[model samples]
Target: MDDDRTRGAGERIADARKARSLSQRQLAENSHVSLSLLRKVEQGSRDATPALVAAVARALTIDVTALTGQPYDLGGRHLDPLHQHIPKLRRALTYWDLPPDGITPRPSAELVRGAEHAADLRRSGNHAQLAALLPALLTETTAAIHTAPAGREREHAYATLTVLLFAAHSVTYKTGYIDLSTLIEERTHWAALASSDPVLGALAAWARTTSLLQAGSYNIGLQLLDRAQADIPTGREPGESVLRMSGALHLRAAMLAARSGDSDLAHDHLGSARRLSTQLGDVDHDGGRYQLAFGPANTGVHVVAAAVELGDGDEAINQASQVRITSDLPKIRACHHYIDLARAYLWTGAKEESLRCLTTAREIAPQQTRHHPTTREVVRMLIRLHHRSNTQLTRMAGWIGHDA
Candidate 1:
């Protein structure tokens, strides 16, 4: 029997179309799905492809999650702290005052070490450790910023604050705390501006652009990147840090462009990133100096991810095969690479290969994969294809909290 969740997807499509006063034929024409097919999908007699679901949602001007519903949402009981912290983080953004009551500005040395440690946890994919550290980091950085009477020390404190908030925004956006993510992004920009450095400010904007990409706001993200790119400082032998920062921004622009279907533009930005990656010192083959990890290996991972996003699965697989995941690579990045490769295999009808990739991802970074939105969708797609024939697939579906 067809489950209500599956049938309910059709119900949402139908309801949304009707709420907009569109007929079946109208929706079919608008979404570019066949009228007969749209009718079947609406009546729940047939399942829709992810692409079809996306197209229909686009036609209706709603989020794809709105159609999938919460049952398919990733992040479970373990993410409860993230859920609680989102509101608290939002309140921090709203107040915009430095140092919550009874807090003293921490020494710059303490703040720097704390940030470096937190970033280490992030690269290792130790999210629980990072989570434990973030709230205090956010508080201490805020206190440090206004503690000094307007000078370079205060500016440096604000820059550190920007980095902390950007890191928070990345986690919140991925874990589905979208509203809080937006606020955190705004705060990053504010801190960057107060830091009185163009590069730092643009990096903050880059973080916000990444959040926009998470929300599928590709056009807006690309626009933001273009604006941010203009701020790339021009002068005297731009050193390693400057190169890494510039490269990170271009790399993200490549991804947004790829998703938007501008292949030439995407490749152009990708080339810019590749050039910068070479200049990023020997340590970066693992991932660069910056938290964003702009390096050769990471750029290659983005190339594969970009291919997957552009629906070029064969290209994605071909590129993925060449990309090596070394131990030094950030587990967060390496995990996403496996997920991207798995999705590519699925696109090419290599179901078992896709399953293997998923298994590897779970082995490498269980929590991140289990909580990721893309991971859920990939598992759902696999279930749709192999659930009846593969016992392992069924078990995997259950593990990911899906009932196929």
Candidate 2:
């Protein structure tokens, strides 16, 4: 690699190691490098020869080209052609000095291309590939934040960090490392970095709250959401929407309480959510993108889910059927809607309908069906409903046996 590129790569490696909570000594031990050498290299005080770089790369279990963007065809040529654009991404971030107004002038061509590729990877269920690319992305994005010349630039960095965290969440969720407490902590740190930007701060808070809710920490999630709502600016433009944030926290809280057999708390949260929706006036579908908040359709879906959990199957089926998932919005919310519908149907003894919905949900977003707790619970219930005597059901039985 060229001298500048080599230095950049070294810094990125150092940042990645740090982000993983590894010390230079620890990284040295893991990478089979001397402690002194690792420190020297990280500080940019010593040149990392190609051989040493390769050794470090192997130790980190990442491709050497991932570090330096060199065209290396090692025995494993798994680095996609898309990896070549990373250097340009790095340069664009540096050139812009990390402005906060959402990627000044809408990011460079190369950066936009990289974002598109990353989004595509996310959509294609190539989570492992995306995870492999994340360290470099995180390092570059963090560096841009630190070197950002202005508040706007810093905001940009925070936004990038938000995206990176979501990507990490996706990968970890897929791999079943579902204890997102650590991710929540990291998100909190990033939120602090963007505290001056209310919108970004709210977004960060929503991300953290969503992770907590997913992990079944309903009470804590509700607390975080309350704090975030308190921080939201008053009399903001109608377009500056926090409706989804308010709605999701209450909706998820209601879901959690219901699933855990707390009917009163579930009702309370669901009621609060419904009231908030009414207070927000006509629905703002566009604003829902940020928080995936329960709209009219989703509010009813949550009610159905809670009702099912509370042993009111008739109410669940009725409420769930009233929801129309074929809205103009994205399909993710629809996926959740269908998954909940499946659960309601199963509880109402409509086994065939439940199976059909589950199949459709899997087709729409297999990851959602596989990773989400509510969806997995619905699948397990279906398995039990069919009276399947298999290892998969046996394992799932043990998993949800306590709840049942």
Positional deviation of 72 in candidate 2, in angstroms?
32
Q: Write candidate 1's Cα lDDT for 195-257 as tens digits.
A: 887777777778787656645567898888788777877578876666777788888898878
> Model 1 Cα displacement at 282 (Å)?
6.3
The segments of candidate 1 whose C-alpha lies over 4 angstroms from its true place after superposition are 1-15, 18-59, 63-65, 68-81, 214-216, 279-289, 387-391
User: Which residue pairs in model 1 clash with each other?
Assistant: none
Candidate 1, residue 103: CA error in Å? 1.4
Runs off by more than 4 Å, candidate 2: 1-135, 179-181, 188-192, 210-216, 236-239, 256-265, 275-294, 309-311, 372-404
Residue pairs in candidate 2 whose N, alpha carbon or C atoms collide under 3 angstroms: 98-153, 99-152, 99-153, 100-152, 100-153, 100-156
**TM-score of candidate 1 against the unseen true structure:** 0.84
User: All candidates' TM-scores?
Assistant: 0.84, 0.58
**Candidate 1 local distance difference test against the native:** 0.72
Q: Which is the leading candidate under TM-score?
A: 1
